[model samples]
Target: MDDAASIDGDTTRPLSQAELDALTDQLIDKLKTVFDPEIPVDIYELGLVYKVDVSDDKDVAIDMTLTAPGCPVAGDMPGWVEQAVMEIPGVRSCKVDLVFDPPWDPSRMSDEAKLQLNMF
Candidate 1:
């Protein structure tokens, strides 16, 4: 239980390495639960999730993009991601940002996603 003391009774300090690692794993697990409606694979595997940043206070910020900027679910997918992130027990907040600078391409996808999509 002591090892789980993320706050260490001081919220101002940064989370320990172990805490960060655990939280990161949990965040990825949560992110993997969110999916693009049109895609059978989760957004994480699809490479839609560009970045995930966690603040000292356990706030999560995500940068993600869609298969296409005009995709039908663009407006709702971020919320789905936020919902998934907020499910983590220790997460204090979640924010999802949609970005398009480096537009999505097949190259970003994981091998598993490629296999699932039959993109071999």
Candidate 2:
């Protein structure tokens, strides 16, 4: 993931649907590397990531939540996510928005995440 990228000397053009999908996949892979401080599972599998949006200009936006509002890393998790996403190629910028609405629950966890935590 590099911060410097341009397509044909233009960075404002919207990406094609296929291009967006491919970039999204890459973004997910990068996101899977971030882990909750207390959880062995990555944030993606842990269900912290609620939404990922990519704009025409390749800007990235993430909507996410924490395991708990009182979690020690509450102040830093968003930045961590932003940094991770910003590292991806073609990502012009990244913004992570933390939200507790529709609050996180065990049901949100991926099957793999549940298995890893022995929640089954």
Candidate 3:
């Protein structure tokens, strides 16, 4: 689904491609501030974030996963992500969906994350 569509199937105001790109960038920056409690790397670079969607109304939706299903913060990480995204100026709302399908793998980590963890 396109980023402009809400989870409830509502369509938000239309935005220019440039505007969407800028919002996406901002969202990503906010996402970078969230970290896994057991991992030193930020979730973004760690590849925990699978997808991000933003609507013209400034609502944000994220699809993310944890390093493991048994991770201690499984119940709280989504809230952390939502709060971080919602704190951004102009964001109307933020929702995070935790997914396990196509489960997370170490190979998903970015090079920076790998380097930080000495995985390289």
Candidate 4:
């Protein structure tokens, strides 16, 4: 193992672009671990997350939304997403952008999410 790997006690090789993409996916997965207190499905599956951008410096920017314009957790979900992104090993920073442009509807949810929520 190399010095950095040894220091981290990780045996995996340094990540390439594909590996980094995988890490980004894993980071997204971690973000999904959190859920809207009122909803059974993850925000990711709910299509609340519109975009995830990772910069060259490993900073992450998330554009997300709530289930409704006046949801109770509106003030907190972005912070939750920020916290989740920051947990990624190489993430230097996280910025959450809360949006309502397209607005949220049941149709935005993933098929699995709809199935889980029995919306379908």
Stretches of candidate 4 off by over 4 Å are 1-16
lDDT of 1 by residue, 1-120 (tens): 333434456635668899999999998898899888898999999999999999878889999999999999999999999998999998999999999989999899999999999999
Q: What lDDT would each prediction earn against the true structure? A: 0.90, 0.88, 0.89, 0.82
Candidate 2 whole-model C-alpha lDDT, 0 to 1: 0.88
lDDT tens digits, residues 1-120, model 2? 445456787545457789988998899898899999899999999999999888887788899999998999999999888888888877889989999998999999999999999999
**Candidate 3 local lDDT, 1-120, one digit each (tens):** 655656586677687899888888888898899999899999999999998887678778889999999999999999999998888888999889999988999999999999999998
Quality of model 4 by C-alpha lDDT: 0.82
In model 3, pairs of residues that clash are none
Full-model lDDT, candidate 1? 0.90
Could you say which candidate leads in lDDT?
1
Q: Can you write out model 4's per-residue Cα lDDT over 1-120, one digit (the tens) per residue?
A: 243344255343445799678877887787788798898989988889988887655667888888888999999888888888788777779999999988988888899998998886
**RMSD for each of the candidates:** 4.6, 5.7, 4.3, 6.5
- All candidates in order of lDDT, best leading: 1, 3, 2, 4
TM-score of 3: 0.87
- How high a TM-score does candidate 2 get? 0.88
Better of 1 and 3 by TM-score: 1
